[model samples]
Target: MSGDGEEDASLEFTPTWIIAIVCTVIIFMSFFFERFLHYIGKVLKRKKNFALFEALLKVQEELMLLGFISLMLSVSQVSLQKTCIKESLMLRGLPCKRESPNSVSHVTFVRHYQTNFPLDFTGMRMLLASESGGSGHCKSMRDWKSWEAKIQQEDDTAEKMVKHVHELQFIKKRFKENKIFSWLHSFGKQFYGTITIDDYRAMRLGFIMMHYKDNPKFNFYKYMIRALETDFKKVVGISWYFWALVIVFLLLNINGWHAYFWISIVPFILLFIVGSKLEHIISNLATKVVDQNAIAIGNCVVIPSDDLFWFKSPKLVLFFIHYILFQNAFDIAYFFWILTTYSFGSCIMGKKAYIIPRLVFSGIIQVVCGYSTLPLYAIVSHMGSRYKKAILPHHMHETFDQWLANAKTNKLKREETSNEGTVDKFWGAWNRKKASNKTEVVAKLEEEMQEVQHEPVPEIEIGIHN
Candidate 1:
């Protein structure tokens, strides 16, 4: 009996080790393939955006994207590898050859899953569950009670994967059924979802795909044209903020800033012209194409009048925000680049240039710009513009119009009565929309609250395991 037991253990151990080694190699190859795909994506995006010259600012952006994608792939690869290792160990230790990878190896569906490498099984399950449900009475069940601390200790991989699958499915199913539920859940999940290395990887491809799907006529040249337009504005914006620092460097120049004055002026003037032209093009394109989508989608509720100048669509507002933010961020980067280049120039010229002053000035400017931008973001967000519009009954519009009039009248009274009171303009719009879809929002809100109640208590806490 003792000899037989030893032989059984030996038989189990050898095959499991072989399988694990093979799987491990496959995982490594998958990671390598992902990296290759990422580089291809980057080259394509850069070409499309026409960030020619592969200039300092554009190069930095490319590097950041690569770093983020690599980090995400690393995290996911680690998680999947760890799970495989754990299963391998279990198979090796146990006397059960039946549980080896070979057991599921023959199953066509399982083989397909292994081949495709889908990141969001939870999403698939949720979509399936929603399709299974009828008349918007969607429901999901999860056995949270079995999720005890001891169970995790005994089966960490199984527990974690199961929990992740359950939570994601729940969110996805709820998203399809309720609008308010979709907004809150989607927004809330973004924090945990995109905040991680793996989450970044998962979303990066989706982002690329989404943009591509939106613009199918997207040739390399068109992409390059758009990219060049975007980048020109960015470079020009940076130049504006760096003008003061440039003057200071000119004063400190031993050969005299005058010697290279024309050279400097040419670049600055060219940047300004390019920036202005790009900004104009982008704005016009947005108003024409982007606003049209907003109108079609019903996202133009707040600004229903033909008063495009006075009341901007949410989509246009967002585009302008991106325009400003991108420009400012580039500007901040340019200041730092100047600081670097000038410091180098000073070193080569044997001038005693203390970079400390430049660093201090740069820090102050960045802080001021960052703080000033917050209000702009808030106003843009509150405008309640979206690319896609919510579909509602015709009666809802009349109801919303009445609510808007009341809210507008109330806002006017407050503004007239007190100098401190300005229009709570965005909320006034929301109040009007709610008046129109009083039934829909209310029903959606109620459904979301119930979902909150039904959600399984989170099994893992960051600081403590529960």
Candidate 2:
């Protein structure tokens, strides 16, 4: 019984299965929830307050973006933590071995007896020292206190260095804000017509909203309508097949197979299938409409409406789907990797301390990764098309140029108005009083001249009549 108890204690918390199950459930729930929202939107469209539907769609998009960012942060945090822990152990000459070197499994710390060591920097140092042949032993409590003080001094120095770096950055920013630099910046913006990735994204979003507004039937309502009209058995069969695939993948994941790769690859296949279907739909619609109405620009055909709808709607949807699915696979793989690289029984900092750093690191990673890749992706995706000659009611380049011209004109007008107001204000009440007196004198002189002319004319008219 004692031996059995010992064995039970030896086994640490391995929550890989839980992570796998939760991720799977989240994926399915998110899909069904989206469908449910679409149904609600359909109902709302019949009401006067259809703005609620638009708000709901915006919220959903924002939430998806937030979720992706969160997932990315989590992956980065875990990866960084794992690296820190491994390096700390190695530095102390401790043995860190995984239970299964080739697969996702828990790590084991060999020749270590302490199970409740703290995860803070000092605690980690002490724990590792103890493990490295009684190096944690000191002559007295005073020695331990001294050692802690030394660590604290080092931490204070590090903090001071960080503060110094921040000061330098602030100084650099102030220097860049000088009049000469500011003028150069404005000049560059005027010359280049400052467009950015965010501008493109905003434009794309506007186009999507316009597309949905123009073609209400081309949305999720169509799918719902089809589902309602289809044979119940066929719908059931399709659903069952989908669920079966999901279950098979989940089982594979549980068995420690390369399920994530399969999951990630499946989205690409679906993207291809969906892309072909969308192309067919678009082609059929094209046949029905006049060629003159649709303008082919680059790789996309823009449909003329109140606003241009870049006709890559299907591709856009497929890209989002693929991105989400790939993210899920990446998250699952990262969790498994982290778990396999670190021993669950090992001491770690309290949740609050651990989480704060992770959050900060995640934010840094998100900003770096987002800015580095997003613009490049946007530019590359929109590059090179054979159909640039199609004349349209409004061209993007012309619109942008007009907007830039208008902005510059408005800025100049504002500056001139401000300068005139400043000059008027500088003269204070003197300028206003002088102007008012001048106007009054002119009015009095005109009145006097008018009276004199009227009196002479009356006498002259009477003599002529006699």
CA RMSD per model (angstroms): 37.1, 31.8
lDDT of each: 0.36, 0.37
1-466 in candidate 2: lDDT tens per residue? Answer: 2356535444254356766897899999989978997887888667523334544554455456546655675566446435534534433422233344445323333212122211112222222112211211112223323433443344322322222211332122212324455445433332231223222222232233444445322222222222222211121121234435544543444222334444544443443333333222222222322234333222122232311113643224324432433333333333333344444343221134343443343333233223322222222222212111111122444587799999999999999999999888878778888999999999999999999988854444445554
Which ten contiguous residues of candidate 1 have the minimum total lDDT? Answer: 136-145
Off by over 4 Å in 2: 1-277, 289-322, 325-332, 335-414, 417-430, 433-466
TM-score of 1: 0.19
TM-score of each: 0.19, 0.22
Candidate 1 — which residues are off by over 4 angstroms? 1-320, 341-466
For model 2 the local lDDT of residue 253 reads 41
lDDT of 1: 0.36
The lDDT, on a scale of 0 to 1, for candidate 2 is 0.37
lDDT of 1 by residue, 107-206 (tens): 3323332333322222222222222121211110011112222222443133322232213321223223344543454333322211222221122222
Worst lDDT run of 10 residues, candidate 2, spans 229-238
